[model samples]
Target: MDPVSGELKLFLDREKIRDCLARLARGEDRRDAALIRASCWPDSTSDYGVFAGNFDEYLAWVVPGSPAIPVTQHVLGQSYFEFDGALDGDRACVETQVISYHRVDFSVEHRDTTIGGRYLDRFERRDGEWRIAARTMLYDWFQDSGVSVDWSQGVMGMPFSAPHFSGRAVGDHSESFFAKGKAR
Candidate 1:
């Protein structure tokens, strides 16, 4: 049987992990780069299979050229977390399954991509709060809308743009904020 202290720690750890996933989903949908950064430690490393970098680089990659389509939702499944005991130490390991939907707009078709992955995370209790210290992503499977675009034709005569282009609103991206502050 688990001690009262151990049970409480487990519960808190699970909740914190869940909250982290929720924050990540919200940040991705609203393009809140700061929120995403807050979810990780200052010098955390991420391994995304193809790309491996620190947390700051990960945020830059996310908010810069996101697909300009409808919002996305990240649904987290049952997670397994093991706390390494606060009395012993302040480290924990978590594994969560994430199912994400990416609403994308193509030249001829508008659809969403369903992607599933596993997030393996190392968490630390810092300043009485749980924060992700490291993360590694494993892509399990993905399904897309199966739409293809031709850059040569510019997709129904649209102007030459990026494959993920969906035309963002002014001031929605971070560039506008920087420009305004610089002009002040």
Candidate 2:
């Protein structure tokens, strides 16, 4: 392939890999198993520090809210990619920085935990599709804010009193929005 075409292909591959990362993050936050599954190969492996296992085990531990942390948001940052061989190689090593916020509701207090981390991933292109073949989560820093927001009082102490005012671990407001065909 010519240099220009090869560059374009590499760019497209990068985009695909980025999309997979986004899918994985969103799926984990929403606890959407199908979307999470689409981000990885069937035989993928994951080492999440607290949980390390095959794809199936990882799926079960991550989806449907394991560890009982009800709410989470994963903010993705810069990603660096390294192709296995030439630009046309089917495998790539990717490292993406992430900032994650988790709401941990304890028996007596609600705490917000913010974690700075990176996802080290091995991406493999199979059948013209890019997906994660292996992944490891590396934690850099963390902070626990004393208390989380009390959603019952609504935002800033102004009561809205509307259902779905706050996001849920399951059946979040986004689910209905997506069900209405708002998301692709």
Best by TM-score: 2
- In candidate 1, clashing pairs total 0
lDDT for 154 (candidate 1): 65
Q: Name the candidate that leads on lDDT.
A: 2
Candidate 2 lDDT at 66 equals: 55
Instruction: Show model 2 residue runs off by greater than 4 Å.
Output: 182-184
What is the lDDT for 120 in model 1? 93
lDDT agreement with native, every candidate: 0.72, 0.91
Tens-place lDDT digits, model 1, residues 1-184: 4688867766776787789877776666666787778788888888988778998787886775356564466788888877775644578888999987776776567676888998999988788777788989889999995653434466678776643343232234444545578954
TM-score of each: 0.70, 0.94
TM-score quality measure for candidate 2:
0.94
Candidate 1 similarity to native, TM-score: 0.70
RMSD of 1: 8.2
